[model samples]
Structures are given as C-alpha cells and as structure tokens.
Target: MFRILNNSDTFITIGREYVLEKYDKKREEWLHIPLKANIGFQADGMIIDSGSETSFFASFDTFNYNFPKGDYRIIKVLSSEGDGILLYDDFKIDK
Candidate 1:
C-alpha cells in the first residue's frame, strides 16, 4: 500500500511497476508488470493537486490473477526525468 501526498503546488506524474517474486518447489523468479488500467490500458499516470495537499493511493492487486501465493515488492519509478529515481521499494505483499 502507498499513500502519496503531493505537498507541492503542481501536480506530478509518476510511472510505476511491480517486481513480483514467485516461489515454487523448484526456484523463484521476478516478474515486472506496468501499472495501468485493465480495460483501457491507458496511462493517466498523473496526480492532480486539489488546492490543498492531494492524497493518492496505489496498490497492486492485479498480480493476484497471474501469481500464486508468494512474496512481492512494488517499485515506483519516477520516469519523468533524471536517472529515474526509485520512489518507493518497501511494499511487500504476501499470501
């Protein structure tokens, strides 16, 4: 789970992806999936500030369909500019 609060006056757009780790009796591997809507595949990818500090919530429930019970990590990539800094990398989902 991620709660982003844009304290700045302007809106920000951030690109996101999930680095999921799936484990079985054999081995474990990672999978990357882009964060987008299931129906449209459109990237709205922007956060709008509503005068006051705007709060945005993001989660990766989509992986439930493809991945079985395991461990996972979500990484938020700031792809707008400069080195693509990783914003968040602590999110772990387990089942």
Candidate 2:
C-alpha cells in the first residue's frame, strides 16, 4: 500500500518484509519499504515518482469499486494528447 505523507512527494512505503530501494537516485545506499508477498496484483513496469503530488494506477483492464459519494470539485489538466495529469492548490509537503 502507498500513502501520501506530504503535499508534494508521495512516500512509497513497502508492506511487511525486507524490500529495499535506493535512498538517492545517484547513490548506492539502499532503503527498505516492507514487503507484502501477497500483493494480489503485479506492476509490470511500475513507475513511482516522488516529483508527482498524486497517486495513480493505470492500464488496468477493470476495477471493482464503487464511485466516491461525496462533495468533489472539477479538476483540470493540461497535457499532450497522450498524457493526463492532475492539478490542486494549497501545496505543502508534510510527513
């Protein structure tokens, strides 16, 4: 599971085992995000970027979920014809 610990970068915390990642993009040090053996799904080419402010999972065929029932606002994005992005205000990053 992944959660947002800040307003800018989304922290990717591993589940419950010995998973490790590079602390720095250009370093040899490794940091661990716990491992959940039975994640039930696979990310063939998972891309988790800290520069993004929101979480997204795409390319999945279908999802078994009910739509959100709450007050929400229209979100707008500007991008090329092939990409989609999100926009929000009151930006802050906190853990």
Give the alpha carbon lDDT tens digit for every residue of 4-82 in model 2: 2223344332211112222333554433333345444342322334454334432112323222322212222322233
Cα misplacement distance, residue 41 of candidate 1 (Å): 4.2
Q: For candidate 1, write residues 27-47 as lDDT tens digits.
A: 555555543465222355654
Give per-model CA RMSD. Answer: 5.5, 15.8
Query: Which portions of model 2 show Cα errors greater than 4 Å?
Result: 1-28, 43-55, 58-93
Worst 10 residues of 1 by lDDT: 16-25
Q: Estimate the TM-score of every prediction.
A: 0.42, 0.18
Alpha carbon deviation, residue 50, candidate 1 (Å): 16
